[model samples]
Target: MRGSLTTCVLFCLLSLGLSYPMMKGKPNDTSSKPFPLEDPTHNLTALADRCTDEGFDAMTLDDQGLIHLFRDGYSWSGFRGAAQFINETWNLTVSVDAAFRNHNKNQPQTHQRMYLLQGSDVWGFYEGHLLAGYPRPISQEFPGVPDNVDAAVECHAGECQTDSVIFFKGDTVYIYSPMDVPVVKQRHWAALGPCTAAFRWLERYYCFKGINFTRFDPVSGEVLSTRPLDTRDYFVSCPGRGHGHVARQNATLMSIKNRCSGRPFKAFSSDELGRTYVFRGGWYFRADSSKDGWHAWPLSHSWRNLQGEVDAAFSWENKMYFIQDSQVTIYRSNPAYTPVQGYPKPLQEELGVTEVDAAFICQSSDVLHIIKGNKLRSVDLKQSPRLPGQERPIAHTQVDSAMCNANGIYLFHGPSFYLYKDVEEMVTAAEPPEPGNIAATFLQCTE
Candidate 1:
C-alpha cells in the first residue's frame, strides 16, 4: 500500500509540472472580469444622472470642448459649421470645389484657379500667377519667349515690307515684331503672337488638358504642382465619383520615403495614376510578389498590376489585415511574394469569428479592431484562441439598425466629414451599457 501511494504521488507531481507551463502563459482571467472603476469622489449616481441630464446621449468630447449632438444621423457634429470644434482646437471652414474635372480616367485636367481665405487676405494662385485680388497692369510680359526672331518680313501688298519682322519657328511659331510699331494700337500687342506662345507653354505646364493634379496651399493659396496622372503612382479616391465604384480597393493618400534617408512624404508624380501609389508613414509595410510576399519596400514604391485586382492595401503592425467581401482576412505581411500565413487556417475555428463585416487598424495605436457583426472586438495577437460563442453576440452590432452597409464600418475620418469608420470609432469610444452599449464602451475605452 505504501508503494502504491508513492506511485500515485509521483503521477500527481508529473501532471502538475506539465500543467504549470500552460498556466504560466495564460492571461490573467481576472483581468477579463467586469470592473466598474469610476471616480470615487464623484457621486456615481449623480454622474449617471448627469449623463442623462447633460444630454449625455447627445454629448461627445474629444480632448476639446463639448461635442454637439445631431439628430439627423450619426455624423461628426459641427463638421462644416463655423463654431464646431474639430480634432480639438482650430475652427475650420473647409470648402471643396472641383479644382478640375477629368472627362476620361486616362486624362485629368486642372482648373488652375484656387481661392483660399484663412484669416484676412483672399489669396489667389491662378496658374502660377499668384495675386491678392485681380492685380493691374493685370498683364505681365510672358516669361518664356525667344529673345530674337530668325526672320522678320512685313507682308504688305503681298510683298516684303521695310518693317523688320522676326519669325523663328521651332515646334510652334515665335514671332518678334518691332515694339515701336503698333498694329492694334497697342505696344505689347506687337509681341502678341509671342505672348500667345508663352501662354501655350504655361498652359501645358500649369493646366494640361490631360489628367493633372493641382494642389493648393490652404494657407498660402499657392498652386503646388500640375502634372500628368502617373500610372505608376497612386491617388486618393473619396466616397464620391469613381471612388465608390472600386468597391474593395479605395486609394486614400500615397506617400513615399527617400531610400537613403528613409524620411517618408508625398512622392511627386506626373503619370496617369498620379501619386496614388504612395503609402503613408508608420504602421504600414509593402510586400512584393517576387519576394515570396515577405519583404519591406520604401513606402513610396510603385508597381503596375503587381497584384492584378489588388491596387493597394492598408495594414497595421506588419499584418495583412483588410476587409474583403465583408470578411476580415488577417494574413502575414509577406514582402517577398510568399504565401500569406495565419489565414484560411484553424484561426477561423479558434477565434469563433465566422464573419468580419469591417475592420480597421487604429492609426494612433496600431490596434486591430474588427466588427464581427453587431459587435466590435480586438483580436489578441498573443491569444491563439478566439472568444467563445457566447462572447460573439456581445462583440457585434445588430445588422438591421446599422447606419451604413456591412462595409460601413470602414468609413474615412476627415476633419469635416466622419465616414463610417469614424462613426464606428466614435460609437465604440462612447461607453454605455451592454449589448447595444458595446460601441459606446469602445468609445469610452478609446477616450
Candidate 2:
C-alpha cells in the first residue's frame, strides 16, 4: 500500500511539471536556514500546496546514473522543497537508492550510492571516506547546512528520523551526522570483518556480512563493540566479507617517518587538493605521504581521453598538465582524479616543438615551462604558449629524471642531484661536456 501511494504521489509530481511548463523563476536560493529539525515535517503539507500545474521538468540523470530532480524549473534547491511535498502528502521518509556496476570484478560487491534529502540539503558518499566534493556540493560551503557531514555510502539515499543520515556503499552501511561534514558513527568499522551489506532501522546503523551483522552505537561510534547483531533482527543476506570471505584490504596508514616506494620519477606535480601526482610507466600514481606505498590512479583512458599513458603531469592554479613526448594536454578536475572535458591540445601549435621530455609550472611566474633535453620554452597559455625570452638551455648530465619546485629545478641521477640555479643561462651558455667528462662537472648535493 505504501509503495502504491509513493508511486501515485511521484506520478502526480511528475505530471504537474511535465504537463504545464512552470513560469520561469529565479534559481532557488540555497543559503536559507534549513527546516527546523524538531518539527521538520510539521508543515510539509504547505509545500505540497505550492506544487501546482505551474512547474518545470528539472529532472534529469547524470552520467553516474543518479536521477536528479531539481525543484521548480531548474537546479536542486534541496530535499526540503521536494521532501516537504512528499512527506506532507504522505508523511513518509524521503530517501533514494540506486545500484551501480562494480567496475572491478575483484571488488564484486553490489556497489551502490545513497542520496538523502532532509530539508534542502543532499549528502553523498563513496569508498570509505566522505566524497568531500563531488558531482555537487553537499557541505556547509554550499549553504543551507548547519552541521558537518563527512561521509555516506552507496544507495539512492535512505530516510533518517534521527539526527544522522544513513547511506550504503560496497559491503557496509554507514551512519553520518549532517553538518559541514558528516562524521561516520562507526569510525572503527575497519576493525570488523569485511562487510557485505548494511542498513538502518529507527536510529541505529547496522552492517552485515553473509549472516553476521554488527550494530554500531550512534552516540559512541562503536561497531559491534558491545554485542553481535543477528539476522533474526532483520531478513537480509550479506555479500560475505568480500568475495572469498577474506578480510577487507585497506590502505595502510603511514606516519610522517614512512616514505612512499616506486621512486625514480620521470615527471611530478601537485594538484589543488594537495595531492602530489607522479607519472611513471604510462601510469600516474600518488604516494600519500600520510600513507605507505603508492596508490595507482585512474586508468589512462580517464586521464585525458588519451590513447596512450600520460608521460608527465603537474597541477597549477586549478588545471593539470598531461605531457606525452612533445604533445601537451591540459586537464582540470573538480572532484580530484576525475578529469574535465576538452583537453589533449597539441603543444606544437603554440610552442612549435614536437618533442618535450618534461614540464613543470614555475611557481615564481605561475607559468608553464616545457623542457626538451637541455632546451627550455616558457609558454603563456592565456594567448597560446609564448616564449617571451630567448629559449634557455638546462645543465644536466641527462634530461630524463627531472623535477622542479619553488626553490629550483633538480635533475637527479639516483641520489646525485644536478641542480640548475639559472636554467636559462645553463641552457644557452653551457656547452655539451665530453661524453665521459660529464661525471666531473655534475654537482652532487652533499652535507
Candidate 3:
C-alpha cells in the first residue's frame, strides 16, 4: 500500500510537470523520507525562491498574539507590527485531522489556548501542547457544519461585538456562537474566492489564498485597497525580502541629507525599549554609528500615520508622545508603535501647552519639562489636574531639543549640545557645561 501511495504521488507530480525530490531509498522501502526542513536560522538561504512560491497551510495567532504561519513540515512566526516576516522557521509537528478537507484556519480560544481542528476532531492547543479531554468530534462541537471547511476566524471587539467564530466553506459561511445556533449565509463578497486561511489582525480582516492575501471589511466584505499582497512581504519578516527593504534602499540611494551640522528638531531615548531617535525635517536617524553615523530615512516610513516633522517628543510609561503644532499623538512603545486610539488630541487639552520647542521626562520621574524658547515649565503628569507648574527662565537663550537619561539632561542648540549633570543643576545652575558639537558627541562623526 505504501509503495502504491509513493508511485501515485510521483505520478501526480509528473502529471503536473513538477519534481518530487524524496530521499534515496529502495523502491519498496517504507523508510524513504521527504526533503529535510530547512534550518532558516543557520542556512542563511531564502525559504522560497520567491515570497509567493508557496502558500501557508494554516495561519493563526499564538498565545502572545504573534502570527504563526504553517506550511509543508515547517512554521514561521512574526509580529503584525510591520509588513515583513522575521527570518526564522521551525519544524512543524502538529497534525490536522483529515475529517475536514482543506481546513486551514486556526483561532484563539482564550489568552492561553487556541482551537485547532485536526481531521474531524477539534483540539484545544495551549502553550505549545494540546490540552486534555480534547480531540472532540467536530460534528459535536460545531453541530450542523459540514466537512471541508475552507477557513475559520474568531471575530472580536472591532470586527464583531459578540464572541463569534466564522467558518468558511466555498460560497457558504457559518457564523457560530457558543450561546446561539450557527448563522448560515451565502458568501457576499464578490472580489475574493474561498480563502485557504483567514484571521483578524490590527483590527482588519485578512483572507489568505495561496501566498496572496486580501484585506477586506469584515462587515460588508468590501475589498480594501491593496488587495492580493504577498503574505511573505506583509506577514513574514523575511530579511532583505520585502518592499520595506526596497523603500530603505531607495531612501539610501537618494541623498539622505545629513543634519549633523544643524540642531536636531527632536531627540528622545526610550529607556524601556533601548532606542534613541533623532529627527530633522522628514528624516530621522536611529543613532546607530556602526551601521552609519547618519542615515536619515523619512519619519513616516518608520512611524506609520505620523507625517512631516514633530515639534517635540518624549517617552513616558512605555508610551511615546509626539507633540505637533497643537496636537499630540500617543503610541505604545513597541516595534510597531501602534497609535493609541482617541489620539492626535488637542495638545492644549492633554498637556495644557499649545506649542513646545523641546520636551523630555527624566528616567523614573513624572515631571515633564516643557521647553519654549529659553523658558521652562514643568507639568506633573501623575496628577489628574495636570496644570502647568511655575515657569522659569533657563540658562540657554533658546534651545532646539532636549532629552534626559540617568546621567543628566542634554539640551540642543544650533549644532551643539549642553549637558547638565542632573535636572537640579538644569534649574539652579548659573552656567551649564561648555557646549559640544552634536556630530562629534553623539554621532561619532569627526570634523
lDDT for each of the candidates? 0.23, 0.37, 0.56
* lDDT of residue 56 for candidate 3: 59
Q: TM-score each candidate.
A: 0.24, 0.39, 0.48
State residue 236's C-alpha deviation in candidate 1, in Å.
20
Give all candidate RMSDs, comma-separated. Answer: 29.1, 21.6, 14.3
Off by over 4 Å in 2: 1-264, 290-293, 301-304, 307-309, 337-342, 385-388, 406-408, 413-447
- Evaluated at residue 156, the lDDT of candidate 2 is 20
Ranking by lDDT: 3, 2, 1
TM-score of 1: 0.24
- Report the candidate with higher lDDT, 1 versus 3: 3
What is candidate 3's lDDT per residue for 184-294, written digit by digit as tens?
444545566576777654344667677666665665667764535555444443444333233324533233334444445565554455567777765565653221112
Q: In model 1, which range of ten residues has the least summed lDDT?
A: 1-10
Question: What's the lDDT for residue 143 in model 1?
Answer: 21
lDDT of 3 at 359: 93
Give the per-residue lDDT digits (tens) of candidate 1, residues 87-183: 1322223211111110111212212232222212222333334444332120122122233221111111111122212222222332222233322
